[model samples]
Target: MNALTGVLRYLGNYAISSVWRLGYGARLFLLTLLYSGESFKRFQLVLKELYSIGVLSLVIIMVSGLFVGFVLGLQGYNTLEKYGSEQALGILVALSLVRELGPVVTALLFAGRAGTAITAEIGLMKATEQLSAMEMMAVEPVARVVAPRFWAGVISMPLLAALFSTMGVFGGYIVGVVLIGVDEGSFWSQMQSSVDFHEDILNGVIKSFVFAVAVTAIALLEGYDSKPTAEGVSRATTRTVVTSSLMVLFLDFILTSLMFTS
Candidate 1:
């Protein structure tokens, strides 16, 4: 009886805490949006954050994209060859990358790389009382710090996703056409014919943009709400990555279903 009571109590507390955090996160997101005008007013801050969040993430994205494409090419060719439809390998690679893998994988990578960085940086600022100091100096940390990073992430994510898809296509070409001896003309022609701009490319871009908003918002909220201590900062950073990754995947499913449910 005592164990059952304890279990119920724990579950209740967990549910309440989750609700509180969600409400707090929603409030923070609204506040960030409200104060985002400062970010645009001081465009250089957004540019600086773009370099930090976007430019720094390029190496991992490109390398991972290339490898993903290579794997898709090799595996796709093998599978299609069995069915005597290997020429369709190009469309397979292109569709897979453009329609799903590119945005999803890039978002996952961004969450690990840039999302954790945003959380740690802001968490440390909170821990060190820097945000408090800003408040004392009549500066809104949300406007000055959080908003710029938010817009930067919003702008960077789609561009990075596009670059990743482009690199993946190039890698696929190298693997399929050069190494695997698939006809270059057929590969290009099939990819061009089968990949619809509105359906495949545009939808991928939309997914990346939605993922950007979720990831950036979650990272900033985790950092801002973390307890003001070293341990708290560390935990917040971990939560940022885990939560952002999960949110991206969840949103991806919803978006994919809505976009492709024809």
Candidate 2:
């Protein structure tokens, strides 16, 4: 009976802690939103962060997209060839990338690369008392620091996802038509006929945008709330990657269900 009571007490405390964290994260998100308008005045900062988060991330996004599409093309051709549907390779690759893999993989990569960087940078600022010093000077750190990075992540995500899909298509074409002798005309025509711009492509963009907000929010919040120490900064960076990845996957399911359900 005592062990049962202890187990119940532990579960209750865990639930309460989880709720408290959620509420606190929501509060930070709201505060960041409140100061986001200030980013307009600091346009150069936003541009710089855009370059950092978006431009710097391009190489990995493209390379990964290409290779992933290449593999899909190869595997897809093998499977479809067995079923006498090899000409549908283009549609297969296009729908796979645009509808699912593109946004999902890009966001995962973004979280690992840009998300961790955001957390580390902000946590380092906190460790050095930069945010506190800004407060002393009557400056809002959220406006000056967090807001630009947040908005940068938001703006960069969809673009990166698009590029990933485009590259994936190209890679698929190279493998399917150029190498495997699938009819180029059929590949392109079938893909064009099957992929709906509004439904498949637009919904993918929406998914990326939603993932952007969730990832950026978690990254910035973890940094801002981190303990002002090296260990704390490291932990926050790790947490940023883990939490953002999980959030991206979870949000992807919810968005996919809503987008596809009748």
Candidate 3:
């Protein structure tokens, strides 16, 4: 009963606090735009995060994205061939990569890598009383710990999204041209012509930014609330990854619906 009550209370606190923080973040964003200096630190942090989140993770995303695209092309071609629309393989690959698979797969990949790292790192810090030490030193934890990660996510997600889209297309090209015997030039041409780049790319990029924020926020919150014990830190780390990943998936659904509706 105590554990159940604690769980319910945590959920309640999370809901209220999340709503409040979202509003606070929005206000700060607007206020920062009003003052050039307020945004500069975030900008620098963003660049660092881009290196960490986008450049550092490049190889994994490329390898996974390449295979995903290849499989998409192969599977799509097989499916469309039965319906006598084998030529539409280009369109199918482009659509899937842009609309759905790109963000979800990329976010999942990111969560497993950086997401867990952020959680474990923060949890360890908290468990070791380092955060308390910072407090004693008059350092603001939010500015020191949270803002950089949040801004980093916002900055890096779009770059990663672009990576996913471009690499996925390349993967599709390989399968379409080499294995499936389609002309390389024609496959590229068809892909270019079939999709609305502005719609697909912009929507995905925006979604990536949002996913970045979601993942970072959840990770930070888990870290902040982690217990002082090793078990507590471990549990917080696990919960951070699981919760962040699930939230990313859910947010993707809402984002896709909103993007496609208009």
Candidate 4:
């Protein structure tokens, strides 16, 4: 009886805690929206953040995209060769990268790399009482700090995803046409014919944009709500990566279903 009672109490507390956190997240999101107007006024800060988040992330995204495409070309060539459809390798690689892997993988990488950095930076600011100092100075930290980072992330995600897809196509070309001796004409032609700009490409951009908002929001909110301590900031940074990755995967599935469902 005591165990059963304890179990029920624990579940109730867990449910309440989850609800409270959700409410906090929603409130933070609203505050971010309120401060978003100030982002343009701090355009230089936004540009700086864009360079930190987007330009610094380009090498990893490009290298990963290329390797993924090369592997896909090799694997697709093998699989299609079995069915005597090796010429379809281009379509296979392009569709895989643009429709699914491009945005999803790039967002995941961004979460691990940039999202954790954002969380840690904000968390450290809180730990050092910098945010409090800003408040004392009558400076809105949300406008000066969080809003620009948020907008920069939202702007960067789509461009990074597009670059990833483009590099993947190039890598696929190298592997399929140059290395494996697939017909170059069939490779480009089939890929061009099969990949719809509106359906596949546009949906991919939408997915990346949605993922950007989710990932950036989680990163900033975790830091904002963290305890003002070294351990707290460390924990928040870790949570940024784990939570952002999970949200990206979950949102990707929902967005893909909505966009692809007939």
**CA lDDT scores, all candidates in order:** 0.93, 0.95, 0.77, 0.93
**Per-residue lDDT of model 2, residues 36-111, tens digit only:** 8888787998999999999999999999999999999999999999999999999999999999999999999999
Candidate 4, residue 123: the lDDT equals 93
Q: Which candidate leads in lDDT?
A: 2
Position 75, candidate 1: lDDT: 92
lDDT rank, highest first?
2, 1, 4, 3
Model 4, CA-based lDDT: 0.93
Off by over 4 Å in 3: 1-39, 42-49
Better of 1 and 3 by TM-score: 1
Alpha-carbon shift of residue 113 in model 2 (angstroms) = 0.6
Q: Per-residue lDDT of 1-262 in model 4, one digit per residue for the tens?
A: 9999999999999999999999999998898889988888779999999999999999999999999989998999999999999999999999999989999999999998899989999999999999999999999999988999999999999999999999999998999999989999999999999999999999999999999999999999998988899999999999899988999999988998899999
lDDT at 166, model 1: 88
Could you tell me every candidate's TM-score relative to the true structure?
0.98, 0.96, 0.82, 0.98
User: What's the true lDDT of residue 193 in model 2?
Assistant: 99
**Predicted structure 2, TM vs. truth:** 0.96
Question: Which parts of model 1 have CA positions greater than 4 angstroms off?
Answer: none
For candidate 3, give the lDDT: 0.77
lDDT of 3 at 129: 90
